[model samples]
Target: MAYFSVRNITKRYAAHTALSNVSIDVPEQSIFGLLGPNGAGKTSLIRIINQITGPDEGEVYFGNEKLAPHHVDRIGYLPEERGLYKKMKVGEQALYLAQLKGVSKADAMKKLKYWFEKFEIQAWWNKKVEELSKGMQQKVQFIVTIIHEPSLLIFDEPFSGFDPINVNLLKDEILNLRKNGATIIFSTHNMASVEELCDNIALINNSHKILEGSVKEIKKRFKTNTYSIDFDGFTGPVNPLLPGGFVLTEDKSDDDLRQVTVTLPATATQNELLNAFMPYVNIHAFREIIPTMNEIFIKTVHAAGNHSINS
Candidate 1:
């Protein structure tokens, strides 16, 4: 069952419709990706879910209970924009935020110290927020967001200011959070991260949900039935030997080994392709070419007839 689900939620601002009948289901203890181009209503829906704003229509439910103000305590949100008091010391600021989230002073300090040590930022504890770099401040903000240990986490571009090493570190922590029973709604423009961290995703464009499903299933659904094979012992052109309805899209040879990619007919099976090539070439490796999330995102958005989305 879905731990959190939005049903036909709509939001408007004056004459503009920020979201139109948008809905999504986030499974418990899983990372659910919320994806869309700018001005696509992703932020609007997030605000509604956080109770920062009310939807013009529809409902949001957490488990079987309809979303209410009391639900705010169970959620942690890290917005795309950073909001920190420049004059406050890092350690003090974190403690204050944690207390606001209902954590006891002693517990908050203990948790803060643990996270500071983990991120190797213990040395910066006494320094004011204004003295830190953008990435350092981002790290502190991230710590505050999760310090309360809320049941559901909403992270919008959480990796924005981090270097590659820190990005991977955050990814590991996010996966670990799920293992520890925390549900997450991740929103970002990084398609590569989506492929790595998201189990499922819902793509919103033009204020509408255009696609939603498991990452593996979506990639398989959009597959083009293309396969690449690397082999040896094939000296001559295999086009004449290949059965009808197979197109050799690419062929590369280096001395003894040759690699070729073939597009099979829609009705053809992997076994059929294997049987046809086995007689002529020694198959070393055979694998299907799956489209990446980046490729799929562009294709789906364009197909939805939004021409100015790239702008």
Candidate 2:
């Protein structure tokens, strides 16, 4: 069952329709990726999920209960647009924010100390926010967001402005949170990150949900029957050996291996593709080319009649 669910939500601002009957089900203790291009209604849906705004039509649920303002304490949100009081001491601000989320000051400080040490920011505790770098400030924000130990966490562009090392650190922390029973709602335009982190995803385009499924399932669904074969010692024209309706897309040589990629029609299988080349060359290896998340994102968005999505 979904720990958090948005059911046919619709929202509008003035004359602009920001969202139209969008729905998503975020399973418990899992990372659910909410993906889309800018102005594709992702922010609107997130707002509804966080109760920042109510939808014009449709109901929302937090577990068995209908969504309400009281549930705000159960969710932790780290928005893309980050802010902190530049003059406030780093430790003071983190403690204040955590208390606002209903945590006792003592507990908040205890949690903050653990996280600060874990993130190697213990030295920054007494420093003013302005004295820290952008990435350092982001670390503070991340700490406060989860300090309350909310059951659901929503992170929008969580990895922004960080170097590769910091990004990996945050990724590891996110996984640890899930392992400890926090369901995460993650939104980002970085497809490579999505491939690495998301278990399930919903793609929004033109204010509608265009695709939704587990990462592995969706990738399997988007297969194009493309295969790559590596061989050497073939001294004949490539086209002559190919069976009818086979498409040869790539041919190259790397070291001692000569590789070729082919697209097979429904009438043929990998066995048939292999059989044709078996007698003529020394086969090295062969493998199917599964579509990457970025490729699937671009292809799906284009096929849905929308363009300019992040690839």
Candidate 3:
């Protein structure tokens, strides 16, 4: 059973449709990625999920039960827009936020101290939020978000202002949360992070969902039937030796290694290409090329744009 499910959700603001019949199923204890460009309704969907706003149509469910107002306690949201009180001390603000989430003051302080010490930010405990750098403030917010240990966590652009070191630190913490049984909805423009962390994803475009699936399955679905091969000891032009249905996309040589990329025609198979190339040169490595999430995101959005025009 899905840990959380959004069923045919639709949201509108005045005359503008922010989301259109969007639905997603988040599996328990897994990292789920929500992706889209600006004005693509990702934020709207998130707001609806957080119960900060309501959908005009459809319902949201946590497990087998309908979502209720009190269910907000079960979720922790770190929005894209930072919300720290600039004049307030980090530790004080964190304690207040945790208490609001229903954590006892004693437990909150204990957890906060552990987190601060772990992140090496205990020195900033008495410092005002305005005194810290953007990344530092982000770290404080992250601690508060997870302080209550909610079952569901939603993070939007969680790594927006961090250096590589801090980015990896946060990544490790997110993975640890999933391992400890928290379902995470991670929204970001960083395709590399999605590739590294997400088990599944849903891509939205112009208020509509254009793609949704497990990351590996989505990449496979978008493949262009291309393969790269590395070889050596080729004496002549290798293009002509390719099978009739194969088209060489790139060919280059570095020392004794000849690297070539080929697009397979509909009639050709990987076995056929291997059979044809093996005779021409010493095959070093041959592997099918799958599209990256970044490439897939662009192509899918472009297709969605063209679809809107054609319709």
Candidate 4:
């Protein structure tokens, strides 16, 4: 069974549909990305999962049972917007939040101490949250979110306000959490982060899910069969000897080295392309140009928008 499942979920606000029959299955202990454009109902689905709002239709399940109030204790949420109490001391506020998630005050302290030292924020413990920088407060919130060792964690743009070093720090911590058997649902506009952390992803567009799959499988599915070959001392215009299905999209000469890009036909193979180019030039480098998550996001969203318009 999936660790978390959203089954045909729908949510509406008056006449505007926030989500429409969206469903996704998140496997156990994996980092699942909940992705979409702005106002595409990713937040709505997240709200439903958090039990902050009920869906108009369908159901969500965790483990073997249907999600219920008790399940909230096992879930942690870190929103994009910081929610720490400004007037309270950082340790006090963290302890409060951790206890709310069902940890005892004593246990919370022990855990907070470890995290505070790990993050090197022990100095901020007694300081009021209002005095800390935005990034510092985010660290506090992150510690609080996981202090109870929740089974499920939902992080919305968790890297907000973090510098590159802190971003990498948090990324490593998150990966460690998954390694320790916690399930995560990550929602973000940062496609690069998605590529690095997500094992699987569901792309929601205009209140509907348009794409969902393992990151590797999705990348493979969208491959254009394009390759860039760099060779030293290649002759001018090798196009005349090109295979029937190969389309030469780019040709560039950088001093002594020549590089060309070609799109392979469905029936063609990389070996065939290499054979055609060999003997004429000394091949120095060759690589397939796989699409990045950013490219896939843009292409898929734009395609969905165009389809909506035409239909």
Q: What lDDT would each prediction earn against the true structure? A: 0.92, 0.92, 0.93, 0.93
Candidate 2 vs candidate 4: the lDDT winner is: 4
> Which is the leading candidate under TM-score?
4
Instruction: For candidate 2, give the lDDT.
Output: 0.92
Which residue pairs show backbone clashes in model 4?
A: none
The parts of candidate 3 lying over 4 Å away from their true place are 309-311
Instruction: Write candidate 3's Cα lDDT for 190-271 as tens digits.
Output: 9999999999999998899889999989998888899998998786876778877689899888888989999998767888
TM-score of each: 0.94, 0.95, 0.95, 0.97
Say which prediction, candidate 2 or candidate 4, comes out ahead on TM-score: 4
- Can you write out model 1's per-residue Cα lDDT over 1-311, one digit (the tens) per residue? 59999999989899788888888999999999999989988999999999999999999999999999899999999999999999999988999999999999999999999999999899999999999998899989999999989999999999998999999999999999989999999999999999999999999988888999999999999999999899998778879866799999999986677999999999998888899889888888999999999999999988885553321
Clashes of each: 0, 0, 0, 0
* Residue 268 displacement in candidate 1 (angstroms): 1.5
RMSD of 3: 1.7
TM-score of 4: 0.97
Error of 4 at 97 (Å): 1.2
Global local distance difference test of model 3:
0.93
Ranking by TM-score: 4, 3, 2, 1
